[model samples]
Target: MNDDMTHEPSDTTGPRRLTRTRDGRMITGVCSGAAAYFNVDPTLVRIGAAVVTILTSGAGILLYAAAVLLIPEEGKDVSIAQELINKQTSRN
Candidate 1:
């Protein structure tokens, strides 16, 4: 005489924000940033970009350049040395 089991649906999270990575950058950080945003390997993104560039006759280069100029870098992780540098510069 026990029948009472109700379950609520799980909430889904949205996609990760796309931003250029400061640490994982190779050239302009576009591929690494995209990899982080899409939750994939950076090499995959690089290879895909290369394939697109080949197939589209260099359009991918333009797109990548645009992304470099438009996308903002991920949250800046300030280091102790950087903090000290900022402090010293501010005093001068």
Candidate 2:
């Protein structure tokens, strides 16, 4: 005899960053951030970044690093003020 299991899956979803790899907030270490976000090997991003740096003469690298530092962490746990801002953004 076997017992039947009849349980509905609970919803465990919420807004996540556009890039699970957190592309937006990654510092110039875009490769690293991309790797983390997309759950891909960082080596791929590293190789890509290296190629871009060589082709673009470090401009890409510089920009990537700048972005990492400037970008906010994804899934930033909402604070009271941030929630208010979100509400305002939604209204208009």
Candidate 3:
């Protein structure tokens, strides 16, 4: 058996991380980050979010807020909600 044939190829792009983008952001960048992850236009995501929010009687707003707290900003490791939970637990 050849040594070269036993090794698997490595990915150059590395794993895809879902992080909020600093560029082209309207607010918290949740839609932009999701758009980047899905490889779609940010505008489309924003429009869809708006429509969902309207149709769902503003439930989408809560979902968007949750995403903002759960999704880490670009260049950061932990998310806002995670940090807050950690702080609260540490204080006890």
Candidate 4:
């Protein structure tokens, strides 16, 4: 009848966080971060991104940019876009 016993054990490595990796980054680490989150190869992600960008007539570029703004970098808490919004709101 113990609550702790009822709950499942948590992952020792902690929950998988999607953050931009500085080591394997080519641009802003968007593709690499996404690859890590999805457990895929970084090269595959990059190629897929390129193909999508081309097929979408450049819409994928915007998506990549948005991801860069939204996804936090490795070892950082807030995303770039969040920080910018916070600064803007504070100034107003």
Specify the highest-TM-score model's number.
3
TM-score (all chains, Cα) for each model? 0.63, 0.46, 0.82, 0.80
Residue-by-residue lDDT tens digits, candidate 2, 1-92: 22222111122374333222343234334454456555556677677877888999889768665555444444445434456778999999
Total clashing pairs for each candidate? 0, 6, 0, 0
List residue ranges in candidate 4 displaced over 4 A.
1-12
lDDT of 3 by residue, 1-66 (tens): 654323221222668778888766899888888887776778889999999999999999999999
Ranked candidates, highest lDDT first? 3, 4, 1, 2
Number of backbone clashes in candidate 1: 0
RMSD of each: 11.6, 11.0, 9.6, 9.1
Residue 2 of model 1: what lDDT?
Answer: 25
Each prediction's whole-model lDDT (CA): 0.71, 0.52, 0.81, 0.81
Q: For residues 1-92, could you state the per-residue lDDT of candidate 4 as single tens digits? A: 65422322123378777888776799998887787777677888999999999999999999998899999998888999889999999999
Worst-scoring 10-residue span by lDDT in model 3: 3-12
Model 1 lDDT at residue 14: 47
